[model samples]
Target chain A: MSEPAGMIHWEAQDSIGILTLDAPRGNFLSDPEFIAPEQLKDLLDQDGAKALVICGAGKHFSGGARLDDLFKLAANPVHLAERMNKGKSLLDFIENLDIPVIAVINGICFGGGLEIALACHIRICSEKALFAFPECNHSLMPGMGGTIRLPGKISWASSLETILGGDMLNAQEALNMKIVDEVLPQEAGMEKALLLAKKMTKDRPRKVIRYILQALRNYKSMPLAEAMKEETRMFCELAYEEMERRKNENLL
Target chain B: MKTSFKTLSVTYDDGLVHLEINQPPSNRMNSLFFNELSSLVDELCKKDGISAIVISGKGRHFSSGADLDDLLQKAVHPEKELSSSGTFSFFERNHFSFLYFEELNIPVISAIRGVCLGSAMELALFSHFRFCSEDAVMGLPESTFNLIPGIGGTSHLIKLAGLAKGLELVLHGEMFSAADALQYGIVDKILPRKEVVPFALEFAKKISVNYYKEKKTLYLNSAA
Candidate 1:
């Protein structure tokens, strides 16, 4: 009922919730506007929220974590570890969400920005978008779950090149690597994300949508036999739910 | 190593082995196909001369995957399914056999063309690299028939393609193009139909030689 907290600007239109990273130029992640765990969880938990789209307010998705913040954390090792864990936890929460989460990338997406996009369920990018783990240039690695998630999106060899080389990937190159699901002309990234979200959730009830998303998460981590059995169980459960819903509607 | 098999033909060239699925009319995996495949891989594991292994199909297809008729028959007689875990299991020792490609330190390249579906797709997923012809078709079509991928197709695909797209590919049960396969990280390269084998060989040789050189360097560096 109340607006979600944090620097994220949350608004619902046509049953889709959009979270704009409302920060200054480059949308540096360490800015005060960064979405906290509680804030994000609150936004996603809202009722009637069919799908969520995360995007930047200005030219860049993010310049990634701030250098000043990194320097400050380096001076306090314990605080640094806790901050790293929190970032990882946020990505994990986004990944395990029971509804679709899409990242609409524009302009510069570097380091933590790229990690955030990778953690989402799907990624869409603008033609002018540039992606890289500039962390290597800063003499650090992507500590916010990028290294483990990168290999799953692209080839292991290419993942190394992207992370270690600190090279930039244009939109087409990202598409070739399958790092992003779709690449649209500049400024069309948000429209494409909305269309895809709409198509995915079309004619499906909230429960069915959630079930599909939850069941999919199992395929990634569960054993083959276990995942198969879980899939069958979900199928049968959905079947029963559909039957029950039909019966109730007829009775009404 | 014994070279004769009813379902496959093995040819050794220099340090590379070309293993072909020879069943006519789309090499379908039946009982004999599994037996031959299991024995061939086991033997190849012991052979010292091989530097890389290349797998392809004899006819138009890399494989049409499991024979539905054979699978149905076995399903009807579930008691025949072997089990080492004290449970009725279809993929008992066969699970290990399918995963053997990954266990090999040497490179395993799947030169895929035509239809690579069902269990065949699972087999390709275990290969270190997959090279396909432009006209190649690939997918895991089991979910369409009310069954899930039995032999690690779900996990391997999720590893190659991200979790969301991987689930969509299997859940939708749609066959895709070699280009789509490459985009999904399922195949490493797409070449002309006539060139798939040659490209696979070249890739295998390059990686195999580089692997040995890297190993020697690591050894020397560690010793120093």
Candidate 2:
């Protein structure tokens, strides 16, 4: 079925929903004044949508945040503060999706473009993909939780190196660092991402899947006791469901 | 026994800090190594009479990059895994302590031998200068596993090589020799194993004098 068009495009092909982002060229994020986090929530919450594949529309996935929008936000200091937190909250929406969110990053990905991919559970970038943070060089800081999430996903040394120095990297370099799953031919990145989404999503258990992901995400951030508690709860829930199935089969 | 927070070791003589990858056996980089080296550099920055810093490793392998054991541990028990900020593992928080090295006000150089991969290469990238022996192998191998170069490898790799070559390295996890490293800007110099330490020391002193000379301008300005 055809997906609706918006700032970030959405479509479902082969039962895998694809989210294509094409704002002003460079994938600059839309101005918050016209469409803030509300637009992103609407896209994610769209009914009948299961898995999401996020990719870029043009040559570069996201050159970075529309710095023009940043300057405008600075102009309206009070209103900007009100709008800023939503960016991070929106990231959580992506992270906590009932279904998986995969990123197929092709061409140049910088700043927000890259951060958008980091929100996805799986990332498949192309060899052509070039990424950079450049926030420090721009005399600004990373918003949209890049510092918190990238470091958590990659490593502290890598995160600081990119943040402190404004160096950019191509897809191959990203692959070695576990930045992307594979560096495929640019044409095949999205195809592979969709294939992965289908394979993982078929006959999947939503609650169990979410819990498993939550366990992985929270383990490193939380203390051992808390992580164990969450894991035990998940185990019990899954076990009880298994026992019920056994009873139905008259094996108990 | 006191854990001396050291992934690599060094000694001071001949007006040089000869750093060695002190991890016994293979000298594989793991969580403890990152933590030890970072803290050691932090402490070293405060000490006096330190002329230069040169990092090397023991055994045949300089470093096998991110320890596969570390990877297996994290993969099997995701629950026991560590976040970069978490204090559970020093290896987990491999932030570039080159800032601390910068604080030391001395030149830093790495004397490479054997294999340097993944986060191990990330450490070498930070040094303003590096010496690789004939047997040195360096690369970022994150893709072989289902991951990306998490540490500063991505940023540093591109800085040393152009975007095009960096792409080739990142995507392929291709291991290059010390000669190629020099051409790719991965290492500043290439020498035999016996001369690697001496070369690094000489390189460090050369740069150290320049560091002191550059800072002397501030001192003169203050006095004036």
Candidate 3:
């Protein structure tokens, strides 16, 4: 079954949730508030998706946010703030999700498109993929956590250059900068992403995946000592459950 | 200035300091190497007008990692080296010494060639930039011995390569080549074996002049 949520088309294949950017042309995000945060949360929750993969419907991942829509929204300050906040929160929600989220990027992932990809836990791109922060050329910057997330994935200097210089980086250059986790042959991004998602989550207990992802996330947000403590606690809890399961199996 | 050391040799060229792991073929780090490293860091801290530091092995291999025999000895009899550093264990002291390289204000570059495994790889990880030769082999390999990297290797690995890739590397404890290291973001650049040190030295000179003011990639993208 396919569920169309605003600009995004959501579908479930086994346990993986595929969210595709479906737009008129080049998958440009015309709506500043592309999808409501609650709408996305409900989609994932109702689908019972163990993992999520975000892609674009056509050849390109996205042409990023349409300039005309953004300029029109900017004419109304209060409306723009409200809409942008919703957009920001939507990406934030995806970043903080307990389950892994992968971005299967094929073509141009520019500006807002790159920001969305940056929010993912892993990024797999095809050789034909191209990335850039063209926002600088337009005398704008990424409004949706791009500045914050880009630096974490790559060097501060490279991120600065990428944003300010506004040059396109091919798949190999993106991989070199650790912008994407893996690069596949042209048109192979979606298949590789699905395979990777299944390999990471299939047959694996949901709780186990959640715990691991949480621990990894904590490593970034929490202090070293606190994160280690949480990891130890999770490990002990898993160990206890394993022991109980073994005992039941032996009895049977 | 003290230029000679048992396990390390320090040389000053212009404002740059080239630190070579002096011990022969494998340069396997032992107690002596750690001792010398601690003292060298102290000297480097005190030195004035030092611009950049480039670390490389004297011979073929960067290092085969820690001397297993020495590590086992220390593990078996921890009490023997208890008095070396107050309040901290030998491993802790060594860890802090490695940490010092990363905390330095000047750029620290590791010119790696041949085998760089276990603790040696950990040392390279502490550097700000790693320029590895095509023939270099690197890994954290401690898990193979039923142990984890004791000296900040896991944290650095995770920080540079992210948690998923880092976890795989440590869990498998397998040796990876320079190409793999570059892909993992562990190595900044890969060059021919002969050019590794010279390229690192030249790059260091260029960046050290305006390290703070300029973007690093500006210098990194420039040809040596």
Candidate 4:
């Protein structure tokens, strides 16, 4: 079954949740609060998905947030703040998901669209993909977590230049800067993304995947000693479960 | 100033301090190497007029990493040798010694050539910048020996490369080429074998004055 929430179309394929940006042509984001964070969370929880892939419906991934819509929202300060907060929260939830989230990007991915891509755990883009943070040209910075996440993904110098210079980057340049993991042919992005998703999650139990992802996430948030302790605890738990499973099998 | 060392050779030119691993023919870091490193770092910490530091190997290779025989002996014997404080273990003391390079205010550059593995790679990872020769072979091979990188290699690898690639490299314990190392973000640049040290020295001289004030990429892109 497929469901549409705002501009996003959510569907499940072989236990992989696929979220497609459904706006045709440019896929211009008309609103910051396009999908409610709670609504998306509920969908993910009920889907029993092992992995998630985010892509656009048509040629372009996204032309980014519509400047006209943003200008209109800026007039009402309270409304704009609320909507931006919702958008930020949505990205945050996606980043913190235990299941791996892959962004299969094609063509243009700029501004807010780039921010959405940054939230994913892995990014695979087409050779024709072009990226930029054009907010600087519009006399504004990225309102969503772009300022924080881009540096974490790439070098601080490169991220600063990318955001402030407002220059367009080809897929090769982006790859060179370590912004995206891999770049395939124009039409091979989705296929590669699915294969990668399957390779990472196929036959892997949900609990094991969750534990591994949680440990990896903890490395970023906690101190080295604390994270190592957490890893040791998780390792012991998995070992104990394995021992019990082996014992039961032997008895049978 | 003391001019000689058992495991390391220290030389100064203007404001740049050149620290070379003296044990030649695949300089394997033994206990003496770690002790010498700790004292050298302490000396550099106390000395003045040190604008930048460059580390390299004496002969063909940077290092073959920690001597496994020495490491295994210490592991099996479970030595009671603790730090002066009597609280920290031998591993923790060595970890802190490696970490001191990263904490230095000046830019620390590594000129790597030929093989650099295990704890040697970990030391390069802690440097501000690493310039490798085309033939440089690097990896953390402790996993193959039923061990893991003890002195912050795993964490630093993850920081340089992402979590997925880092975990894969450590688990597989495979040697990667200089090109692959550059792709993994482990090394900043790859140059010819002879140019590696000269370029690193030139780079250190060029950026030492405004290291913290200016962007690193600017100097990296500038001609050496």
Clashes of each: 0, 22, 0, 0
Per-residue lDDT of model 3, residues B1-224, tens digit only: 77468999898998899998888899999989988998898888888999999999989989988876565444422233246442135566666688788877788999999999888998998888899999999998765543456566766787877865775566457788899888878888999999999989988887886576235566667753
* Candidate 2 lDDT tens digits, B48-88: 77777777777776687767545333332234334544322
TM-score of chain B in each prediction: 0.87, 0.78, 0.92, 0.92
**Quick one: ranking by DockQ, best first?**
1, 4, 3, 2
- State the weakest 10-residue window (summed lDDT) of model 4 chain B: B76-85
CA deviation > 4 Å runs, candidate 4: A1-52, A62-83, A96-101, A108-111, A130-143, A146-182, A194-252, B1-36, B47-52, B58-60, B64-92, B105-107, B140-175, B182-191, B194-223
- Candidate maximizing TM-score: 1
| C-alpha lDDT of residue A222 in model 3 | 91
What local lDDT does model 3 show for residue B21? 89
- In order, the interface RMSDs are 8.2, 12.5, 9.8, 8.9
Query: Each candidate's lDDT (Cα)?
Result: 0.75, 0.65, 0.80, 0.80
- Winner by lDDT between candidate 4 and candidate 2: 4
Candidate 3 lDDT tens digits, A1-252: 112255778899978999999887888987655677678778888888888999999899988889998999899989888777777887888888877788999899999999999998788899999999999999999888899999987899999999999999999999988898889998888888777777656655776667656766777889865665555445434534543454566821
RMSD of 2: 12.3
Task: Let me know the DockQ for model 1.
Answer: 0.07
User: Lowest summed lDDT over 10 consecutive residues: which window, candidate 3 chain A?
Assistant: A235-244
Ranking of all candidate structures by their TM-score, best first? 1, 4, 3, 2
Clashing pairs in 4: none
> Model 1, A7-75: lDDT tens per residue?
467887777889887665687766322566677767666736678888988888877888887888779
